[model samples]
Target: MTDALDRIRSIALLLPEVEERVSHGQPTFFVAGKQFAQFRDDHHGDGRVAVCVRTSGMDEQAMLLDAAPDTYSRPAYLGPSGWVAVNVAADDVDWALVEDRVARSWELAAPARLLEAGGR
Candidate 1:
């Protein structure tokens, strides 16, 4: 929906230096021209978005899996590393969480200059 897209775009704007485009038939938010997060729509209960992010205090990937396994899963190959996939459509998506992860992903992918401009 346009509303969801708008929300995502708005979040992307928060990342000082990032690009937003359509990739893999979905809205993708990139950092340094690399994909960090994407939105997908599925008719089934399958995942409707892939949110890749970084963690510090604890393993972000594991955080999602342990906190919300039904809605989040380990990324295909990066699962062992620390990348988690969240199902935005699985439940009432917490936009705040989405915003946080997208911001974190952007932080990870964004360059230092860009991060500085984005106010970290």
Candidate 2:
């Protein structure tokens, strides 16, 4: 759990203007005052450790859930808002994909100026 949280912290903090805060008992990442990612460990006793991130929309969320049902799931609270939880506690976890998701979420939450500045 610590490893997953640490990795998420490292990845999320690398983005421009990103900040970390505890929300709902988990570490959440924000950019430009908008939440982008959250590190979840057994959230609500679901017994899953995941990094929840915002997608482009419901279509992307459905696609991800369809593509990798084992690796991805629609999180409880954020699921209705087009957020997908990527399981990072698995032995075969792909850090690159996690980083990509984090970057994409940051882009979604970041302001236009930050996007223009670029580089996560």
Candidate 3:
């Protein structure tokens, strides 16, 4: 869980104007005051350590869930809103995939002005 959090923090903070805060008892990443991703550690005792991130929409969410059932899941509270919970704690976790998802989530949450500023 600690390693997963460290990896998420490293990727999330590289985006422009991103910040981390404790929201809903988990580490959450935000851009321009809007949430982009959250790090969950056995949230609600569900026995999963994952990173919950917003997708482009339900279509993308469903595609991800269908394509990689082992890596992605519809998170509890955020699922209705097209969010994906990525299993980052797996031993074979792909850091590149996680980085891509984090970047995409940041893009979804970033405002136009911030987006124009570009990410790192």
Worst 10 residues of 2 by lDDT: 111-120
Q: Write the per-residue lDDT of candidate 2 for residues 48-72, one digit (tens) a residue.
A: 9999999999999999999999999
- Clashes in model 2: which pairs? none
Q: How many residue pairs collide in each prediction?
A: 0, 0, 0
Across residues 1-120, which tens digit of lDDT does each residue of candidate 3 receive? 798899999999988999899999999999989999999999999999999999999999999999999999999999999999999988999999999999999989899987776654
**CA RMSD of all predictions:** 3.4, 0.7, 0.8
Instruction: Give me the candidate number with maximum TM-score.
Output: 2
Quantify all predictions' global Cα lDDT against the true fold.
Answer: 0.66, 0.94, 0.93
Error of 3 at 101 (Å): 0.2
Off by over 4 Å in 3: none
TM-score of each prediction: 0.70, 0.97, 0.97
Better-scoring candidate (lDDT), 1 or 2: 2
